[model samples]
Target: MADTEHSSKNVTEVSTDQQSNQSSKVEFSEEEEMLITMVYNLVGERWSLIAGRIPGRTAEEIEKYWNSRHSTSE
Candidate 1:
């Protein structure tokens, strides 16, 4: 009984961790993409300001996304 309970607890903990990991992924909607573009054109590379205009997005996340999409790395 004790081993079974412990195993179930571990499984529950793992499930919770997976949920958190999934939530951490950043998914931008079409509107968000358009907003980012318009905002970027207005204020190039000012990540914090751009982030402020978008809800639920951190400056670091916005900056990373912009760099990944637009960085001139060839």
Candidate 2:
């Protein structure tokens, strides 16, 4: 039972690490950067409106992309 629990914990840790690495791989291009900046400028704090203006982009998607780019650079 102890061995099973340890193995499960190890597996979970490895999976989490893999997910973190995958997330770190995400990034934005220069065009994406400009778009995000433009959106913020146009809408201020209204992220939904800004996201709507960009075809197929959601607020969460933009945030995730930016975060991933930052993480990779760091």
lDDT of 2 by residue, 1-74 (tens): 99999999999999999998886565666787798878777766566776786777777767666554455652
Worst 10 residues of 2 by lDDT: 65-74
In angstroms, the error of model 2 at 51 is 3.2
Assess candidate 2 and give its lDDT. 0.73
Whose lDDT is greatest here? 1
State every prediction's TM-score relative to the real structure: 0.64, 0.60
